[model samples]
Target: MMDLLRSLLFVLLFYPGTLLYVLTVIIVSPIGDAPVQAVVHAWSQFHHWLVRNVLGIRIVWDGAIPDGPFLIAVKHQSMMEAVDTLHFAQCPVVVMKRELTVIPLFGWVTRRYGVIGVDREAGASALRTMMAEARAAVSGGRPVIIFPEGTRVPYGTSPPLRPGFAGLYRALGLPVVPVAHDVGRLWHRGFVKRSGTVHFKVGDVIPPGLKRDDVESRVHAAINALTP
Candidate 1:
């Protein structure tokens, strides 16, 4: 009963807060990237407040976050970590699906942040485009994050990575940092956001120039390090 009330409150607060933040972004967009980042940071901080005050959830980071100019391959179990990535990374740019670029306010902010989008069905051309954006983002001193599985897997499930991750690694020629976390049990894909600490464990940074298979295996193992 109490949990239900908290969930309701969280949902009620989230939409309005999101709208307010999006409006703020629009107003500040002309100021350039610093203001945009400030707004994004504030938005992330707002969600943190909601998680702790409304839902009684806390975040526990396990290791040192990488600096930048690197590729991050993360385990995708829920939306919680995706937002958390915004908090953990320094000057981060994410590799996301092209469809997300059309998502109204959210997509507007994504584009504002210079996120790289890929059309998976476009084959070689898509890879070329993704690589170009990724290269530019890295050259500009931002870490690139990609969810290896490409989509959220339910708790306790470990799926094989999508093909694009490896391609990005090879094309970008940056160190790959793997992040592991188990947040699905609490903040699931559904509506409920349970209370607890979500641990984000950072694994070793795999240097660039390795074979595709070698890189994939290393990243897969590193991301699942804390899974059991």
Candidate 2:
């Protein structure tokens, strides 16, 4: 009963809080990227506050959060980690699905804020576009983050990475930093979120230019290291 009430309160505050931030982003986007980024940073902080206080959850980091221009491949278990990334990284350019970039006002702000959107069904063309944008982002010294698994999965499952991860890895030529976390254990797709600690374990850096199979194998294992 307490969990249900907390979840309901979070949902009640979440939507309005998100809307306020999104509108702020939209308004400030016309000024410059810096202003937009500040808004996003604030938004991420807001989420952290809610997750910690309202939902009674805590985030525990086991390793150093990677800095500089590296390809960050993360384990995707729930939406919690997605928002958490913004709080963890400074100006990370996240690669998301094209569908997300097509949303109404929210999508506009995401594009303005520099999210790389990929059309998964567009075959090679999508890969090319994603690679190009990723290169530009790296040149600007921003980290590129992607969920190698492509979409969220239930806890305790280790799925093979989507093919696009390999292509992006080859194109970016940046060392890969794999991040494993246990958010899905408490935060599922539904509204009732349980209270517990979400552990984020960052793996060692995987050097670039390895054979596709070798790199993929290492990343797959690293990102699932904490999964049970």
Candidate 3:
């Protein structure tokens, strides 16, 4: 019961407090995309403080965030992975669900910061459009981050990734950095939070070749290999 109460307190207090702390970020974020991006990055770091103190979750990185301007395939677990990525990489262009683009404050800010949205239901055609946008974003000097799994999965359960990652891989034709992590262990929905460490493993960048048009399976394998 104490654990549950603490968990509830952590969840309820964090959001409003976070917004209050970064009110300036929300207001000035609209000044320009880069300024907004910079604030969001700074906010993510601040967010780490909230998560660390309130939820008592620790994040530890075993490898390195590769040099930017490449399409990086990341395995998304729970919500923590989404929030934590800000501290892990140079503000890469995030591949997010189309629905998220409609949110009030975050949506507007993310759009300003150049997030690429995808409608998963539109199938292959949607993926092509997203890839094109990703290419343009990369050219603008930002790396693209995709959760190859396409959706969040529960701890220890692997969900099949949408094939969009393969399409992106071939279309972009840049080096791909595969990132894996143990985020769900500490941050899964309904799980009581306590003091613990989350491990993130950044693997070598897999440079592309002309003959291949798919790398989803390889990316999945690489990420899963890092799981405990």
Model 3 root mean square deviation, Cα atoms: 2.3
lDDT of 2 by residue, 1-228 (tens): 888998999999987999999999988877988999999888888988999999999888889876777899999988788887886677999998899898998888889889999998999899899999999998998999999998899999999998889999998899999999989999999889998888999999999999999999999999998899
Provide the overall lDDT of each model, using Cα atoms, as 2-decimal numbers: 0.84, 0.90, 0.75
| Preferred candidate (lDDT higher): 1 or 2 | 2
Off by over 4 Å in 1: none
- Alpha carbon deviation, residue 167, candidate 3 (Å): 0.8
Task: State the local distance difference test value for candidate 1.
Answer: 0.84
What TM-score would each prediction reach against the true structure? 0.94, 0.97, 0.88
Off by over 4 Å in 3: 18-26, 210-214
Alpha-carbon deviation at 204 in model 2, angstroms = 0.6
Which candidate number would show the highest lDDT if scored against the true structure? 2
- lDDT per residue as tens, model 3, 136-215: 98888888888888888777876666778777888888888888887787777765865578887887778786344346
Model 1 RMSD in angstroms: 1.4
